[model samples]
Target: MSEQVPQLQQDPQQILEHVFGYSAFRGPQQAVIDTLVSGRDALVLMPTGGGKSLCYQIPALARPGCGVVISPLIALMQDQVEALQAAGVRAAFLNSSLPFNEVQDIETALLHGELDLLYLAPERLLQPRTLELLTRIELSLFAIDEAHCVSQWGHDFRADYLHLNCLHEQFPRVPRIALTATADQRTRGEIAQRLDLEQAEHFVSSFDRPNIQYRIAQKNNPRRQLLQFLRDEQQDNAGIVYCLSRAKVENTAEWLCQQGFNALPYHAGLPAQMRAEHQRRFLREDGVIVVATIAFGMGIDKPDVRFVAHLDLPKSVEAYYQETGRAGRDGEASTALLLYGLEDVVKLGQMAAMSEGSEEHKRQERNRLNAMLGLCEITSCRRQALLRYFAEEQLEPCGNCDTCLEPPQTWDGTQAATKLLSCVYRTGQRFGASHVIDVLRGSENEKVLKFNHHQVSTYGIGRELSANEWKGVVRQLVVRGYLEVEGEFQGLRLTEACRPLLRGEESIELRKLPPKARGERGESRRDSVAADIDPADEPLWQALRGCRKQLADDNGVPPYVIFHDATLRGMVQAKPQTPDQLLAVSGVGDSKLERFGEAFLTVLRESQAAPVEE
Candidate 1:
């Protein structure tokens, strides 16, 4: 006996304030909403925490029918639905996790117009039965989340996303909005083409995440370095540590646990149930860390993640940006720390070269890897380079990254470059960096002596620099396109770009090897969100957090689903004592004010009543 929900046809601004408790629209959200409400299509490229959801959610509630959303991840859909439901909006999701009866109930509700928003995965929405059902109900719009998946060049591509253009073909009149947090110019074009969004208006927001401090250091005992970072700065805060392999994920998680930190492992190889449970714990609990590969972070909705660390190099700038973008999602000051070495570059290069794909695909991948390496090696601002890669211009240097805080010294390396190139050529260019370094350093190792490289003209010519210094030169050369990694064993080969440097026609300036580890040096620059709180207000903050945890547990939702950390911080700072006062908080809507307003007010009142120790 379900009843059809009435569509209010309310103004978008009213919907934003009354339902979601936001005062106004952020960036291009209002324009995107207007486009959809006017029955037009939009392609939006906003950052992860840039209020992308409001672009469609407000329009859906204002329009006359349920908004059908195509999402890529089951967990993401569940989180969004829960958050919307908390705001008193009728929302539901269809995924394999639901039982048969629940699915039937949700489908029945959809038919009766009991839901304002409906979320479905691409595979399910493409089914004939689902398509048939959609035709029977009025759909306000079609929202495609993570729309970059439609591009084969995208980092998180899904084959099913390629068929999503059918939405345009099947429902020509339904206004559609495709949204993504990470997409290069090339990927954006592909997304528009594959999703049939060529005619859609494009909204590209600034890609900068200023609250995150970008720091990439040379790998010097990476495990110990990670431990130092956590213990020194983010000891009790929730964060994610990304590793490059499944074994590394498991090992890092287990090691963190042994070191007395709450940690979990997540990867495709883990059992589905375990992965789900781990993800659940990460979202619902506090101070929990998940060490995982790239498989784990596509659709995570947690907002208070304090930091994201990379123990190995990412393959491309897009992957690095998307992965690190997971942190400080609440717009708090957070850290993005990366530890890399010459070996990481070689390993990633080998992977790109050996991967199965078209030659063009392989070349693009190599170019992407080079870009990523350049990002790590650059002497200027990291944020500027990152934004530039996405075709966004940043004229001024960002004072937040490692280089800006402590600029690296540079030296004339023309002589060093010539010596290294000659060594590679003398040794036949068939050996890897290590053997080549040994030959240059006159090691007389078994391999070097056996190859008769000890008698070469360039033998021991690079003795002016240490082995590590020589590695820096080689790494920079490879990143600069003067050297290329090739063959099954990843031997270094000289490209035509190296001829000028070797022939003395061109001189090069290279970054001097840091006398100390960059990680230890950059420790003082790390900013934690907790630092924002006044020392005297610590007790009140704890009480508020405890209240949030209890309410979240009782309601069986993540703490953030009830109220984000920013909202809680607002409550603490304002100490609202009445319903009207509580409603002034940014995230407090009419629905939330009615449901949890009094409980929070009571907490605020009790805090006021406590006497000062002084």
Candidate 2:
């Protein structure tokens, strides 16, 4: 049975402005907080950087007792606790990183109600000793972060999530909240069943990130292409380059460093300490590129990531969305550029086939892979394609994506498909796309002559199209299910879906690639991120950040925990002269006003910028 505690209610807005310093809640955060403080369960589906934490954190502070957050990652727990503490909330954590004595002290504090929010890993919460300790105290609520990890079909799954359902069985009256950044309909149902949140209020925020510009390009000299993209789009801004393998991550990092870019490598195979140091540097320093595998980023709290480039294909649309969502978290203009070719598709398929999972799970994984391919080959707005996958409908094309900016022209592809498919069949489907393309373009080299004297009628017949153009046709056909790259050889073979095309009964219209290279400036949307301060006050803004960074370094925490960019902008605009003047600015809570108020005010007085508006 759960221990009963006295009910205490506080105005959430008062807490929000006075403690956390937000002017108002974004989207459904207020409603979610209201429902939770009223002792009702809720399930929140918000995009990354969408203030999901505030929904639970505010309620935890407003209602009686303490909030118990079941977090999956140790780093995530630490980051969240540090941020809350900076916001003047009573937050702490009990994880393996702490000593036994420290754990005991936290447990004592929990029992005595000395804490407002206590974060514990799911594994720790399920332990017998921890369960006994919890039974001796009162809990405000049970909040689960990253709820999608409970889904067996999710990209990142943890077996221990299955045991989380016991929270309800143990404390039937305690309300629970499950929160996630990404989940499809099936995964949502799985989360509800696994965490006993079926009856909870469902709050699904918009999946669109308008600040992120979407771009997909064909692979042609990928190294050169990546360098061009970084220079043209990001211009030395901090970003991430995602690769599929550890060796490639290392090589890419080394290459980027040799080219004078501050770059580092991160993967599961690296030494744990080394990986930690690299991640720390990436977080602490400015304009450092971290070339990493998918293992590196899950709930990274950095808000200034300018771009996310993919040298290889992601396994599914969910994976792509979650990874790309990490960029431009500050609502600034960012870019998600993916460069893929035939090998990415073939290798990803082979890996999914060889993975150790149940047959049904594998089938589902293949379906997800196909969906990702569909997004890559979409002819309309890329944002629409992404949003539609999550059951969201956008009636009009978004003017932000590459398609809406530069629509791909359609061409009659029936003859090109006939030429490419015949080359594959004549070559015995024993080789991959590169070789098949070579034969199609009538490469009468020794290998072509050795393979069969180039006797096929399709040979030399495709000279009208460039090699790049023909490769495009082959890729589109493979994506459309008319051809499959199979066997250990990774050769192209015809599926039943290809019979009509081969029999000349089906006409094909394939999208033509953009003639020129696309970059951030080519988009139709205006530069949407405006400077929050006046041009005359830009130097003061830099000085304020310098002070914040100095204090953050002294305190051994991320700079954002001291004050977010938005808060600093507010300070610059307001030019507060005293503690009382600062309190009126948004994000200037009592605790922050006391800690950072004097240093910031000193900077403002030295600059002597304009007076506050209104």
Candidate 3:
């Protein structure tokens, strides 16, 4: 049991300060906590790092019995439990990772009312034995984390989540809180309907992660672009690079390794043990990068990840938001770089069309993909567009995205669009962008001449524009729904939405292609995880990190579990030499102060006594 467990009747705010070491609630946390404490229900829609856990963790401590958390992230359950235990909360998780004897011991503890909180995988919790065991004990409340998985339309949907309403059916008297970081209005309704939380109060926090600079570039030699971004900006920082396929993940990881980086590959296709080891290294070590597909990063709680780069396009805005949200989780400045191209769009569109879903499902997915592409091509603020997709409105430009920092120039491409659409139509609309572009650029290539496209009326009519420029126009047309990709060859075809532009009834303003390489834009932004540190305090910072590493290694946990980088930064700024002063630092709760205060205080005192290196 953790030494810092407060009395059963302690105030929620007291638990927040004494156990978690925070002064106040962020956003709707306090209100949600109050709702749960009063034995009501809540449906929380906060952002990734908006302190969702405290809403239930604090309420559980204040209420009568133990709080049971149902999560789908089996890989992360142990780390979550360990972090809570380190904070002096009597937290334990029942998962396949534990031996039978340990599971029996934990069950014994729960039956004896010795645990304040318990974490369980949803599938495990649904078992007959687990249900019977739960009926034998008092439960403070039920918390459903990652509740968006209940919605089939959600990107990370899990079939097991469909039956979570059983919690509501079986434990009607227990207050329930279902929480998720990413869900639009439609997905939220689906979650409520699926989880039987229709009457639960909904708390929707702002989805803006202003600290993350959103940047998307035209994919030209993506590996080189990714390497440049790493070498120039995010050197020696913990980050994640997402690829669309397992092979790409592996190849990218190996290539990065050859380029002298600490990169590892993770995908569902990898051996389970290998994936687990890579995930462990990423969580436990510093300056390590994980090159993975979408299979990774659902419940990752690593706080210091500095960047998330996507070598290919995400399928939807929700997925893009969720994946990018993993970065800058500690509220420090971070970067989300995406290298995208027309081929990515074609591939994703074909995938959506060929999926096994019903027509309506496929249509919804196609619309979602188009919206994501719109976000990429838009000349306006990316943050505003992203928020707007989730039904949250941001009135002002964020000045943090690629467009806001170096706004792209827009040109009147209505004539150019008409010419390309005309070319596609004249070329039989059965050819892909490259062939259409060749016909437009007057290339007299073998394919064009063989197909007699050189004799078409619109052939060489668009000679004024370069091949790359024509490709951009085609991509924008496809993104705006004026065009669609179909068939095995991925040929371009016109949509009804293009009628106005084709008839010269509408003028289209297209973003001018940006420079081949965006230069030093991120350099001006103080986005590094350690950007707040002072040069003169370097020695103290190193000593604090060293102390944290040693403590974590001795305790067999990640270094952040000992003390987050934010807490160390707090320590450095406060320079606390006494227990009370150290406790004054944010994230330093009574339990952590008691366990770690002396060692850090000694370091502070010794730093004061050491002579200046200069």
What candidate 2 gets wrong by more than 4 Å, as runs, is 1-6, 516-532, 609-614
What local lDDT does model 1 show for residue 197? 91
TM-score: the better of candidates 1 and 2: 1
lDDT tens per residue, model 3, 99-132: 9999999999999999999999999998999999
Error of 3 at 493 (Å): 1.7
Per-candidate TM equals 0.96, 0.95, 0.96
* Root-mean-square deviation per candidate: 2.9, 2.8, 3.0
Clashing pairs in 2: none
Compose the digit string of candidate 1's lDDT tens values, residues 1-614.
Answer: 01123344899999999899999899999899988888889999999899999999999999988999999999899999999999999999999999999999999999998999999999999999999999999889999999988888767989999999998999988889999999998999999988889999999999999989999887767888898888877877888999989999999999999999999999999999999999999999999999999998887899999889999999999999999999988998889999998788888877877888889999999889889988999999999999999999999999999899889899999998998898888888878888899988989778988989899998888887888888888888988988877887879889999998888899999998776443455444233554677878888888888888998999999999889988888998898988999999999999988887887888899999999887
Error of 2 at 602 (Å): 0.8
User: Model 1 scores what on Cα lDDT?
Assistant: 0.89
lDDT of 2 by residue, 1-614 (tens): 12333365678899999988877889999999888887889999999989888899888888888889998887788888888888778899999889999988988888898999999999999999998988888778889998998999998798888899898999877778999989999999999988888888999999999888898888887898898777665655778999999999999999999888899999999998898888888777778899999997786888888889999999999999999998988877788989998889988999889999988978998999999999999888999999999999999998988888878789999988988887788778777877787777789788888877378776788888888887889899999998998898888887788778889999999989666455454532212233446777777888998999998898788888888777788888888888888888877898988887898888988888547546
Rank ordering of all candidates by TM-score, starting from the highest: 3, 1, 2
